[model samples]
Target: MLRARRWSTRLFNLQRQGRMGTTAPIDGEEAAVVGSAAAMDPAVDWAVPQYREPVGLSRFGDRVLLHTILYHLGHPDAGAYPPDIHVFPTQISIAAQIPHAVGLAWGLRLRGEPGAVLCYFGDGATSEGDFYEAANLAGVVRAPVILLCVNNSWAISTPVRLQTAAGSIADKAAAAGIPGVRVDGNDVVAVREATAAARRRALAGEGPTLIEAVTYRMGPHTTADDPTRYVPPEELAAWAERDPIARLGTRLEQAGLWDDDRQRAAEEDADRRFDAAFDAAQATPLRDDVFIDTAYASPTPQLERQRRLLHDERSRGAG
Candidate 1:
């Protein structure tokens, strides 16, 4: 938890300093991420995470890759690594990765592989059509996928209460003929147990499971957002009482698993690592034509004209 807090602070600071393009701070959702990822076997599991899942991605040994991506959001790729090196590129569009996760799980199952795909998303994504379609397809195909919904109570400025009339996001899984569990997202132990159970069910061929981790997003949706405009100060203070990192740190300390010294060391380590990664990312060469292939193969006439103009300018400069 302390580690997560430190990284969150660093990431937020990077965003503020214009080092990172945009980032969703996970200050209050660390427990949900750490707990869920802690239950998985990294070698046999795949995690498809959204932008807000920093803690989850870190647990999967992608810390360096994460720092690299966070440092330069516009980089063409994640430093020549595989998708799951740390976490997959964070999905900006809502619920678009759901079907991809389900398809991967289905493929693995067909190959008789004993692995599960844990796809993380926010409560807002539940309202998207792909959410239902993916869940239904996973159920029908008995895909080894775990739909982990970090219901952080708000999607940008919209509260979960206003986003859905459903009693809970977990309840939606029942319609897909899969077991659904709602766990306290602030409680690391509860999240760990719930994730473990879900993985077990998937391995047993019981089909996919939906886990709705009811938590809060303590920070603004992003550096660009002014959450104060929508969220009341009192509510923010209330959520602060349930801060996931603090609560878990307290628990670990009580159990003789953590201490102030260890906490300090972890913070220092994270800071050092972040500094090194920031330097490395800044030192990396930037391709002059990196944005040239961002669009489809058949460029629009306007784009072609712009390309020709750039070429002409380069040729004249060479002359």
Candidate 2:
């Protein structure tokens, strides 16, 4: 979680400097992401994440971070992962990944594979129709999937109250006829335990579980957003008091498991990794017309003509 926080900070700065694209900061939501990820067996379980989660997905593999850097660099291959990487590409479309996750989980079950799919989305996604359809199907099919709703209180600029009328995000799960759990998102241990319990239930042939991780987003919805406009100063301050990293660090220190030296080492390691990944991303050669090449296995006549036209235009411009 500390590493994720540090990396997110650097990524945010990179965006400000115009070296990277706009990114959603995982500032206060680190524990919710890292804790649930910690509960999964990377070899068996699959992680389907929305855009905000790559930094916190290190539990899956180092490649997740590497690909994240590439993604921020706007590489076409950013979505391409080698077979061993168990995470799906970060989906920018709201709630679209939910149904995909359900499909993946159902496919696994049909094939007699052993694993559950962990789908992470924000509370805002629950407002979309895709969430309902996916949840309903998962329940009916008894698909091994966990719907983790990271309710960070806001969806871009829209507050949770404006997004839903439900008392809590977890309450929506009842319509799907599945278990709903609300956990303290700031508490890493609680999130981990809840996720582990959900995974066990799924593995035991129970239906999907909806976990509402109630927390607050400490930063803007994205680099393009200005939270100061809508978020009240006092409310922000109140949530700041519950910062997940500090809360976890305090507990670990009290248990004698953490020290300043260890903290510094982790920060240093995170910096080194961010630097290395960014450097590699920048060093990668640009692949011209990569979208055209990858769009179809066999390009139709019109697409082939379009590709040629694009190449010709580039060639003429170069000359």
Candidate 3:
């Protein structure tokens, strides 16, 4: 998982260099994101991420090149519910994907599929109506889902203080009559254990669990953001002391799982892999957008006309 953080740093640099489009930086929340994902079984668990979960997706698909393509293009079809995976396409809306994740868990329970769903969202998403509705329904139906909210201090530019008066986001689970847990988001072991426990409860038909990971966003919200404008320099410096990688590195060193030599080799390998993947993503041919095939069944006349217009627009752009 620390390796993933390293790769994301390079990816962020690429985005900064204008080799990519929009990106949501996941620098400080790597443990919260990757640790939770590492606990999920890709074969049966499902993840609905809100634009900032590439590290989690890496747990499911180690195909760095494919993920590179997905991130670089940011195409609609790229996230159109790809087949047979634990993760879905990156969500764009604030909290809209929460309901979809609840329904997925509910449907899986209805079909007796024994599959659980994991949903990721930021602190700001909690203020949205969709979040409450989805939480209520998931609790009522005992949906097998784990709602992992990464409360990374700030939601874009809005800080958590302005978003909710509650002491902790995890406490919100009580309104739905489910378990809520607060963990040190920087502690990878703690996050993993919490997720594993939640997964077990879900599989046992114990309903959903809401987890609030208390972490800080050590960097800008995204490539488009300028943290220096709003975030305090001292605040960033304070969180720097709680760096998840550094914390995890100490643990690994004690366990003999890591050393300076191993760390150096890992960093070099990650850079090499990312460079290759970036080049491959650039070289791979992109098929023209086909809006007509988006609809599963028959399209109405108006829909067909719209699709034609979109296709024409894309064709013109390509030409």
Candidate 4:
């Protein structure tokens, strides 16, 4: 999990350096993401990730190229192939991908596929109309999907207390006629167990289940947001005590599964990998006329004119 944090932190730093766009930090949420991802078979399971789900995407072999495509908001469909995994371009509009995941599961079910779709979202997304709508459809049709909510206790500037009056986001799933379970999001082992069970049930056509991994967002919502304004220092310190990566490392140490030397080596390895990936991403050639390129199959008259202008500029060495 510390390795996961290393990757997330490196990516977060890259975003700050203008090498990438705004990114949702998963520094504290690594356990929830990695544990859940580890429970499934990457060869079969599908992950419909939000912007913050790099842990899952990385576990599924998503590489720097995936991040490159995501940063540019480039079309991933053309590049999404076996073992590369799937991640929806970070959704600024909350809860938008819920229905899309449902549709994917519905199609998979129609084809009699034995796999589950894991949809990641935040606690704030529960308030959106689409969240309930999609959950209802999944429940009614018994779609092979798991609704996983990483309740990090904040939505940008909004605290979770103000986001909902309910005790937990998992409870909302009850209204949609689905089972809901709350687990220790910081406990990677527990999360893996719960998600594995949920996946089994989903593949059996039992119905959609909502698993709320109760955790906290240790970092600011983004590089642009200041968490100190709304979050008290004491609360932050308390959450820090329960830091997911630290907890996992401690547990592994106790079990003799890891040691300080191993931890340091892992951190160093992750840092080197991230540095190489960043360099590669920076060296990648950007499409010269992407701004004027028509992404659609059929270009409109306006797009055609823009393309011609770009071509003329290139020919005249004015680009």
Candidate 5:
């Protein structure tokens, strides 16, 4: 979770300095991300992500949290992973990956696969039709999928109250006839336990689970956003009291798992990694096929033509 904070901070700053592509800030939501991922076996489970889930996806093929930066920087193949990596490119549209999770889970069951699928989305997504559809389908088919909703209390500039009428986002799961759990999003252990319980139920053929991780987002939706305009300073300060990493660190410290020396070492190790990743990302040759390569598979007929045209243009420029 500390590493995720460092990555998000750097990525957010990179956007401000025009050194990287756009990114969503995950400053205060580290526990929600890490805790949920701690429960799933990435090798067997399919991990699907919406745009802001790079932190959660870290358990799988987040690739040191640099591939997400690479993809945002318009690098082709940055989103690709090995079969066992079981992760796909990040979806930009809100709640877009919800149905994909349902589909993948159902497909896995049909094939007698051994794992469940875990999908992460924001509370704002609960307002979308796809969210309901996916939940309904998973419930009806008994698909082994866990819908992990990070209810950070804000969707871009909009508040959760404006997004839903329910008492809590977890209540939405009641309609789908599945178990819905609302946990302390800032509590790493609670989040992990809730997700693990959900995974167990899914694997036992009890159908889907909806986890409403009640948390807060302490930064802007993106670097381009000005939270000060919509988010009051008092609100930010209030959430600061519940910083997830600090809460977790306190627990670990009590358990004798963390210390000042260990934290210093971890930060130093993180710095070295970021330095290496910066060099690697910059070393890749910019090519005409970069955007085309971002495609998940063989380019469609139209995309192939586009790639050819780009190649020819680059060739002409070189000539």
Candidate 6:
């Protein structure tokens, strides 16, 4: 969690410095992401995450971070993950990954693969039709999937009250004929246990589980958002008292398992790792015909002509 937080902070800083594109900060919801990811056996289980999660998904693979950096760098290869990674590329379309997760899990079952799919999305995604369709299908097919909905109180400028009238996001799981669990997202242990139970159910062929992790977004929804306009100052302050990283650090300190020196070391290591990845991403060559190359299996005559035209224009400009 410490490393994840530091990486997130560094990414945000990069965006501010105009070194990267728009990025989401995993500020207050670290536990909800890292804890749930920790419960999965990366060797077997797969992760499908929305855009905000790559930082916390180090539990799955370090390649996730490298790929994310490449993605922000506008590298075409960012869309591809190595065959063994067991993680899908980051989804920016709201709630779209939910159905993809369900499909992957169902396909795994059909192929007799022994693994479940862990899908992560935010509360804003719940409003999308994709969430409902995917959840219902998962129930009907008994897909080995876990739908983790991180309810961080606000969706962009929209608050929870405006997002839904249901008592809680977890309650929505009932329509899908699955168990709904609401866990204190600030507590890492509780989040881990909830996800573990959900994973057990999934692997046992019981079905999918919908987990609502109640937490707060202490920062803007993204680098482009201004939460101060909608998120009350007092509300942010109150949630600050329950910061997931600090809460876990305090518990670990009491157990004699953590200290300031260890925390500093973790932060420093994270900085070094991110810097190296950033440099690697920068060094990667950008493909000039990436659009034509990735858009089709074989380019049509019209596309071929356009590609040549583009190259000719570039060549003339260079000369």
Candidate topping lDDT: 2
Question: Which regions of candidate 1 deviate over 4 angstroms?
Answer: 63-72, 83-86, 291-310, 317-319
Give the higher-lDDT candidate: 1 or 3. 3
lDDT of 5 at 186: 95
| Candidate 1 accuracy as TM-score | 0.89
In lDDT terms, how accurate is model 1?
0.81
- Flag clash pairs in model 1: 62-86
Please give the distance, in angstroms, between residue 128's alpha carbon in candidate 3 and its true position after superposition: 0.8
lDDT, candidate 5, 1-319, per-residue tens: 8878887777778778999888888888888988898899987987788877775466875463666767767777566655667876788888889999999999999999989998999999999999999999999999999999999999999999999889999999999988889999999999999999999999999999999998999989987788888998998899999999988888899999999999999988766776777677777667756667556476788998888888799889999
Query: What lDDT would candidate 5 get against the real structure?
Result: 0.86
Q: Which stretches of candidate 3 lie above 4 Å from their native place?
A: 80-82, 295-319
**Which lDDT tens digits does candidate 4 get at residues 1-319?**
6666777676677777776666667878888988998887866777787777754467666473346334533433323334545444455578998988888888889998777888888999999998999999999999988899999989987889999989889889888999999999988999999999999999888978999999999998976788888988998899999998888778778999999789789889878776776665566566666545437667778888988987888889963
Q: How many angstroms is residue 273 displaced in model 1 relative to the true structure, after the best TM-score fit?
A: 1.8
Model 4, residue 51: distance off in Å is 0.9
Residue lDDT tens for model 3, 1-319: 5567776677687777876776676788989988898889987889888877765467776663356445655644456445665676777899999999999999999998978888999999999999999999999999999999999999877889999999889989988888999999999889989999999999999999998888888878888899888898898899989999899899889999999999899889877877776776676555554555566567778887887898799889999
TM-score of each: 0.89, 0.97, 0.91, 0.90, 0.93, 0.97
Query: Against the unseen true structure, what C-alpha lDDT does each candidate score?
Result: 0.81, 0.93, 0.82, 0.79, 0.86, 0.92
Candidate 1, residue 215: lDDT: 92
Off by over 4 Å in 6: 316-319
| lDDT (10s digit) by residue, model 6, range 1-319 | 8888888888888899998888888899999999999999999999999988888988888888888888776678886888878889889999999999999999999999999999999999998999999999999999999999999998899998998899999999999999999999999999999999999999999999999999999999898998878888999999999999999999999999999999988888999999888888888887778889777888888999999999999999999
Instruction: Report the error of model 5 at residue 36, Å.
Output: 0.4
Alpha-carbon RMSD, candidate 2: 1.2
Instruction: For each candidate in turn, give its C-alpha RMSD to the true structure in angstroms.
Output: 3.0, 1.2, 2.7, 2.7, 2.1, 1.3
